[model samples]
Target: MDIQPTSGSAGQTGGFAAGGAPSSGGGLINSDFETFLMMLTAQMKHQDPLNPVDSTQFATQLATFSSVEQQVRTNELLTALGAQMGALSVSQLSGWVGMIARAEMPVHFDGQPVTISTRAADLADRAELVVRDESGTEIQRLPIDPGRQELDWAGVSDSGAPLPAGIYELSVDSYAVDELIASDGVFVHARIVEARNENGRPILVMESGQEVAAGDIVGLRQAQ
Candidate 1:
């Protein structure tokens, strides 16, 4: 799979700073507001008696500093949010290893089935679910509900037999009002075989041997 490598991954191209840092290359050394205040105070104290520092110039400088400070604060907040999101994703995905996830797929359900959910296109008259094993053999096929909001699967065989309860991905193809839509289904029930740090971010390795970042998941649950 072609993936854009992030700094936390081993093969990533560049790195990212987790938190705030001084600007690279020679630039402003001190906080802009502090610098402005210091300069303004010096000017006031050393100004010619007849020509004091202009009020308009001081106000402009202060305003500039205020804007710069706000920008710095905003950048810091965004970085923190990103880190928090990554943590949440890892926690959520970790829960799905032994649980059943609802996603769209062509896999069939034989006995008591585990249900997965996926959105079908409005124009889809019929959708197909294709299930493949580790050897990449087509094991099952199921029709989809064109009108219903979601599709369900119990991870069964085409003959309605119970297959081994494990990770099975799905691929969807639907036609709605003569328009075609194709969607990819992921098995959220796989165990996290490994945790990899790429480009300063975390990637979860699924038991199915799929690699995905924490941000890729939408939901998690115990498999029935």
Candidate 2:
């Protein structure tokens, strides 16, 4: 328990923003094209035979409208494709529910043992697991084996009492004799409760009440 204080959790929130999907301008453009057609027809009908509409100008107008319409159609297609891609990606992530993912982040201890993954410094002789509360105050420190990659924290404090269920920041501190050598943030194993697409990217909602980006997760496995 000879651990020094460190800058703890900043109470950052992990989340999703269900932004509204953009509207397609297809209908509006279609309506405008219809209006243009009507106007062109009216002009042609009202013009005297001796002063007919210039054919070149009429052709140019039609070509310009066609080009704009084509571009709009392409844009609509691309938008639809992007939506499909996002949905497909989320559908694949949906299977992540009920699985355990490894990521370095604060974990909510709900009276259950939380598995922590960490790496000790290369030259360290001793290591300790440091625990902090939601407010970033160091509350507990416990000895751990140097270079140990994984361990299950029993949610107990330095006083040997079960900690209340809440979010806690966890890390591993390495020391060489009297001087502190290095500190590494620890990754905790948490079960995925939900998966979603936020801003066209996959997001995982963990049982620990934290949301993590799929790319941030280092590992995944069937929940034990």
Candidate 3:
């Protein structure tokens, strides 16, 4: 359950350097703030009574320092909040493993049937399922009932033989007589094998090695 660094990340207070971020950084305003106070105290002590420091300018400088300090603290808070939310999201996604995730994307086939879900287009009288390989070459086309929303791709080619194990793209073409009307990618179902957080977003890794965003899931269901 450890989200040990999957990849490298810049330090937490990297961007806040120009603004004097106080968290995990050095030589910033917080450090400068102390140094500035000491300098100011010395200046006041050594100032000639005939030409004392101006009250108005001194107040303005203090106010500017106060504003910069507040800004740095705000950045620190935002970093903390982002971390908490990312952790919470990944923890929630842990339950998704062993469940089915339905999404619209290229599918990997390994000599097994892949379930494809489609949204039936009402305008077309005829529908055809088109399968393309990873190279974008059309490999198979089959007539399908226009009203059918789900089908299991048998991973077979036109030669009545099994297709090799690889990634394939699937889409449905809707035709109105001689005119092609709508073409939409179909949803391919895969099981979630692992879930991890990447830059505050949950990434679900499928059994096929495909990665899907947690928010991109079109449907979820228990595995049969």
Please tell me which predicted candidate would have the highest TM-score against the true structure. Answer: 3
Q: What is the lDDT ranking, best to worst?
A: 3, 2, 1
Over 4 Å off, model 3: 1-27, 42-53
Q: What's model 2's overall lDDT?
A: 0.76
Candidate 3, after superposition: displacement of residue 81 in Å? 1.0
lDDT of 3 by residue, 9-82 (tens): 22221111223423333347567777656555655555445555555545555666677777777887898999
- Provide the RMSD of all predictions against the true structure, rounded to 1 decimal: 15.0, 19.1, 11.6
Name the TM-score of candidate 3: 0.79
TM-score of each: 0.44, 0.66, 0.79
Which model, 1 or 3, shows the larger lDDT?
Answer: 3
Q: Flag regions of model 1 displaced more than 4 Å.
A: 1-33, 45-52, 102-204, 212-224
Show the lowest summed lDDT stretch of 10 residues, model 2.
12-21
For candidate 1, lDDT tens digit of each residue in 1-224? 12222222222212111122333222353553454565456654555545444556555555655665667677777878988877766665554555433322233333445455554555667776667775667777777664544434677666766788555556566765556665556332334456555664777665555666656645555544
At residue 156, candidate 2 shows an lDDT of 88
Candidate 1 residue 36 C-alpha distance from true site, Å? 2.8
lDDT of 1 at 125: 73
* Candidate 1 Cα lDDT to native: 0.53
- Which lDDT value does model 2 have at 106? 93
Q: Which ten residues in a row have the lowest lDDT in candidate 3?
A: 7-16
